[model samples]
Target chain A: MKYNVTITIALKEGMLNPEARAIQHALANLGFPTESLSTARLFKITLDATDAAAARETAGQMCERLLANPVIHNYTIEVE
Target chain B: MKYNVTITIALKEGMLNPEARAIQHALANLGFPTESLSTARLFKITLDATDAAAARETAGQMCERLLANPVIHNYTIEVE
Candidate 1:
């Protein structure tokens, strides 16, 4: 079966995110009273798997091995 | 008031996505029978706005002007 998967990766809470800060500053400069900003990365993958369970397991392993940095990132995988 | 916004940016349908292709190939090579993959960029922003309506408008404009490329990318904004 073919599975559609989505992985959302984000920095762990309390981690300093300079990119978000820069975006907030940019918004402020653009006349938007921005106080703060946070950013996340989303990846969508379609693959052939035996079942939804297998797809989820594979995707979670992918996140652990490559897609997310365990030290600073947290990721969630959804399979359909 | 403070508004939390999420902007999801993605390549328009039918566009060639080399990054997705690369990820698919990587997954296939990793012993996952990946047939295809799609990717999207998600940005989370927290800002100060007058109200939800204003926040939505500002975020939509931001996506239009800076966050997303109109020709090749489509974006959606959600304000909370």
Candidate 2:
């Protein structure tokens, strides 16, 4: 099935550089722009996985590993 | 421009009857199921308005008039 995974994350309030902050911070510290930066929650990411479980797992991994901070960022996933 | 107004509202965390609660309440009290309802935030409401200003205005009215409760439900409008 074609699973639609939409991830929405708001910049932690009071954090400067929502659009470029993360990228620039990474660049300044690590000397490179992290590839996972996104504009806002208005993102639509599509994945064709075998089933809902697999899709959810993939999304969860992405969120935990790269996309969001488990401490401050919370996410809701819908598998359709 | 073809304006795309997507409204997403979550059931208040403590409120019961998310899917049928609002409808049932309206039905029990007002004697009919209210027409305005939705399943989570997976809503895509499309409108072809004349301009961005008009589209924003229309969306604002809809939020204030029906779709969301200003106190709890917040909305983001995108025009494309």
Candidate 3:
């Protein structure tokens, strides 16, 4: 089966995100009042796998091995 | 009301994403064979809004004004 998987990699809570902070400040300047902001990287991958579970597993492995930094990043996987 | 809004900004189809290409090659090296990979930036924002619609509208403005490049990127907003 062909699977399309989406993975979102986010910084762990309490980790400093300079980019997100900058965005919030910029938004405030633009008249959008934001209390806070955080950011993540979303990856959409297509591959052939046996099933949805297989695809999810493969995406997790991808996250751990290459896509995300384990120490500070948390990843979520969705397979379709 | 306090709202949590997420905006996902992705490159439009046919636009080249070099980071995604690099990730695909790196994933290949790590033994996870992916047919293709694409990437996006996700922003999670917390703010005070009248309701979900207001929050969603504000997020759309943020995308248009700062978060996304309208010429090459498409953005989606989800408010909770």
lDDT of 2 by residue, B1-80 (tens): 56665555555545553544543354335332222323344234455567878877766665565556777665666555
Name model 1 segments beyond 4 Å from true.
none
Q: What is the DockQ of each candidate?
A: 0.70, 0.02, 0.88
Better of 1 and 2 by lDDT: 1
Residue pairs in collision within model 3: none
lDDT of 2 by residue, A1-80 (tens): 67776656555545454544443354335332222322334233465677989878766765665556777665666666
> Please, what are the lDDT tens digits per residue for candidate 3 over residues A1-80?
99999999999999999988888888999999899899999999999999999999999888888889999999999998
Model 3 agreement with the true structure over B49-80: per-residue lDDT tens digits: 99899888889988999999999999999888
What is the per-residue lDDT of model 1 for residues B1-80, given as tens digits with 9 covering 90 to 100? 98889899999999999988887777677776566678888888887788999889988888876778999998988888
lDDT of 1: 0.84
How does candidate 1 fare on TM-score?
0.89
Q: What residue pairs clash in candidate 2, if any at all?
A: A17-A21
Per-chain TM-score of chain A in candidate 1 equals 0.94
Task: Please give, as one word, the docking class of candidate 1.
Answer: medium
Instruction: Give the whole-model CA lDDT for all candidates, comma-separated.
Output: 0.84, 0.53, 0.92
Listed per model, the TM-scores of chain A against the true chain A are 0.94, 0.54, 0.96
